[model samples]
Target: MLPIALVVAMCLGAQASLFLALTSSQDRMALAGEHELASTALREEQDSLLRLLKDYAFWDSAYQRLSLRLDTAFADENLGLYLAPAHGLDYSFVLDGQDRTIYATRGTAKTTQTALTALGAPVVRAVSAVRRIGPGGDPRVVGFTLVEGHLALFGVSAILPSPDSKMRERPGPRALMILVDYVDAGMMHELANRYRLADLRLTGARPGSSANLPVTLYGGEVAGHLTWSPYQPGTNARHQLLPWMLAVGLVVIFLAIVAVRMGRASARELIASEAKARHLAHHDTLTLLPNRRAFMERLKLREESEQAGILYLDLDGFKEVNDVFGHGAGDALLKAATERLQSIVSWRGILARIGGDEFAVLITGPLAREGAECLAQAVVQAFDEPFETAGHNLSVGTSIGVVFDNGDLSGEEMVRRADIAMYVAKSEGKHRYRAYDPSMERGRELTKQLESDLHRAIGTDQIYVLFQPVVNAGDGRTIGVEALARWRHPDRGEISPDIFIPIAEKSGLIVALGRQILREACQHTRSTGLDLAVNLSPAQFWNDNLFEDITSILEETEFPTHRLELEITENYLLRRPEAAAQVLNRLRRIGIRVALDDFGTGYASVAYLKRFKMDKLKLDRSFVERIANDSEAASVASAMIALGQALNLNIAAEGVETEDQARALRIAGCTHLQGWLFGRPQASSTLMAEIPLSRRA
Candidate 1:
């Protein structure tokens, strides 16, 4: 018995020593992993700053303003409190060719520069070194610098010129600088919070430290030390392990003692792990909501019961936010929107973000049409206020498409119908909700077909320009003609601009279509010597070749610019005031008259009207249609005409389908009228008599 006891004791000691060693090694490895993770996070943060700096530096506006040595306005708008606080930027600056600072912001807040001497001598040398490389080639400089005894990540990028700048001449190379806080207590705390570290610290390396990490740059310059201690085992865990070690002797003495039960616990643990895996597979990571697969699964199960309601939500003006503020800001806004939606939808239904800006909610209860509409309105109203995110106040809207699912249809079909309804809501005007109806499907299919056909019709002879006479309202004489685009599909006959123009605009094909129409109109009406008005799409504002294209077409056809009128919608002008103003000014310089089409239908202010200096305003058909019946409508039309006269602008009324409407408009002081009553839009060949055959090329 003594020899057996001695053998058991030896075995027990070996087991305890082995367990402790394993625990110690695990702790060491975990500490090492934390250090590596922190290092990687810091590097990623630095990279993000560099990317943002590069984006700002390579912009045309920055290039132009910095090269001209003017950055006050740019700084006020871009490098202000919003950009820095939203992006967590500590410092940013634009420098001219002479290495002089144009503007600078610091501390996640834009502040007036008190002095440059506070940057310390080391930073000054670093900035000088970056400037010596000269701007252009997009040279990027990133490193850690000791500024005023604080370690900071600094980056510099040369400003590159934009190929499509509105500026007549390209600017010379300039540089932009950026800095982010690093190796500070606040920064360390932030990292700890993000990484869930218990003891993350930035301090000097001590003797016998468990882990010592050096923050270094590309040139291998050590900036600071990141030191951390290993996590210790819990007291309860140590006590538990001690009891198990003490039992090892008894277990070795009796073989049955070592064969304790574990199968049931293991089985339960395995089942829980599997359940967690399944849940993760069905949910979205970013929003932590059900993914498409999970939503479809839920939808399938719900369909086994009675009817269900589906609300499809699409964000409006989301693309603009992404275009202006980068994807990070977009992501922040999406998360914010998701939170708002969650507050409204908790315990009521399943909400999921199926696409970038698309979300869906499945309601599994009996809901009347009115109830569904109220819910949708509530959702719309939730986004009425601007979302404050990343230090910027951004405005966005939601268009909800609602549909009730009958037992006859599948989950995908209900979602599709809701999508169709949502698109209709967007088409009418965003920030509203629409219910699904059977008629919307047919319209959707027709729009899809038209979009498909328009692509093929652009280069073919099927698409052509038509001329509708703009007649003098006082008499029956034709004064000028408005050129309109008409598409004749191989199988579907003539498609009106009203139907296809919106599709073209949505599909981003309007630029090409507009150019084609302009070329055709110019070619057909150059010799007429009568004024030719052609509508311009808002998409043309972003087209770099717009001015060149119009000028080249005019020169090719020898079309007199003085006799050409380019009509633009008020909505487009209001959306891009500055850019549109520049385009209009350039066209005026080329002797082309500009007109505001559908003037009162959009946000028309006297200030914008004056800024554009357009030569004509066209009264929308809504006012014209109601002028004969509604006194308020008549007064508005008369007021518009009077406004046009006061501004010394010619006024034309569109959509005059009857003599009553025409007479009303004429009496209201409208100078011209164009509609079916005057003449249906006809082919340029057929309008020769109205415009005169001598004017045909």
Candidate 2:
């Protein structure tokens, strides 16, 4: 149909075009495949080799042997190494973090000297790069420290075999090794993706194989991969391509792309995890407020001013609520109360719940006192509205103790003072608040001082006994005296029993002091020939053998038991009614007269007056002090006296300071009186000379 020459030309053109197109397509497919396979194969080879390298990294034979020889933890216990084989580079050595060579066994092993420069020669320098190495530069060392002579933290670099060495040096031991110790969740994800395992993704992307990636699996950038003989198989990929005549790369490239992406995601996750951990450490898990540690840090800064206050708020009846409504209701109530406190004190103070049902607010500036008071009031008022819990109406109270720069106190000290104030409020009556009193502070300080002094006092025998004369009150006849202890301080002069008596009670030194005083009084009885009266406390009465101790003293001293009088409070009788009755009866049987001291002041009702066998009733000074002002007080006194007489009990009025008061009591049928008007509390030796009451009686 056409010319022969034109047909020939068309045939040649078509044949050439077909040949060129086939070549171009084959080249592109081969290129894509090889690039992918090379990347994946390189990664797979690297990973397998890395795993083998890890085996050597944890080579217990070497690291454990070294640690046992050093007889210490030398480093983090796990000596680490890293090998970067993909970039025609590898380094290996024992690293003391920072890529600083703790020891080295690269091609050039060190036998002796170890300046970091020589020890960290090849692998070490690369691992210690300050910033991550460039796409193709050698590794470098960055951060390292020998902390407290204990641990050499290795945060910066990975030390491994030489970069120049080829991989497969030991079966599958690649030249690159990394510390698995720091491999976090993200890093584990990276490792999982590197193998092209299922659910293994890179850069949040799904991958068919290592087909079209520009980089490899290692965190560092990789421009190339060297896969030698003994190539591993790479099939069963989700996506596969036909093999080119001269290429095996598509799958590898696909895998590599996935690996790079996975590494990045892992990095991002690691950062997020670190941030969350730091935040949690400073915050309270329950309230989401700054915790005690964080609060202390803030308080430490304010301590420099010494001009701060604290509000110690304690839920007064929280325990009762817990007992009645269950802990769940209590917890809900606490949460509600905390919210109330939070709302009130948020602007002017730092509030924290340092203890269970005990919250505190630290204050700065002059407003500390005012702000603390305001916050404390709000906390008290918060519970005024009854809460419904478990179908029951629940009510609670708070006792707030406020300290407004009362004195410079530590955080613990502030807490203590606030606690004391809270206790004071509770003691006075709950649902109330109190400011820190200077007297209370002084009392605590003095008590601490007394505690210290008491330890020395017994050893040095600084306490000595003094006797005060007790009289018949009627005939002014001299009776045996009361024994008292005087503290002869080395520098501060005398401390009275009133000051140290409470100290002794709180410190449990009362028993010891009582013993010393008793021994001293008996020693006096051994010398005197008259009646002796000793005051006993409720605490002392807990010892059932108190009468025995007294009898043993009297029998040993050959002193008449009838000449001794034992005085106790009605409060003590109320505590141990049956025991008190028995002990009093026993003392009377032994011919020792018993006197009820401070009788009307305690729970000494008319029923008790008749319940216990008694010989005498001693009127408390409170009633005696008001005799001149209040006729009702005198009537109370007369009622007590009449009750005593009705029970056939001798009546004694104490604190009779004036002759007029004594005359009034006598008119009211009181036969005995003891006061300064009669005689001061002078030493027994002085009283023996000043009063001639025995002859007058």
* Candidate that scores best on TM-score: 1
User: Compared with the true structure, what per-residue lDDT tens digits does model 2 show for residues 186-299?
Assistant: 433653344332332223233334433433222343322222121112221111322321143324444344534443444454445444444445545445565556666766
Name the runs in model 2 displaced over 4 angstroms: 1-401, 405-414, 420-446, 459-461, 525-529, 693-697
Provide the TM-score for each candidate, comma-separated.
Answer: 0.53, 0.44
RMSD of each: 14.0, 24.0
Name the lDDT value of residue 458 in candidate 2: 59
**Over 4 Å off in model 1, which ranges?**
1-307, 315-361, 366-399, 403-417, 424-452, 690-697
Say which candidate scores most in lDDT: 1
Model 2 residue 331 lDDT?
81
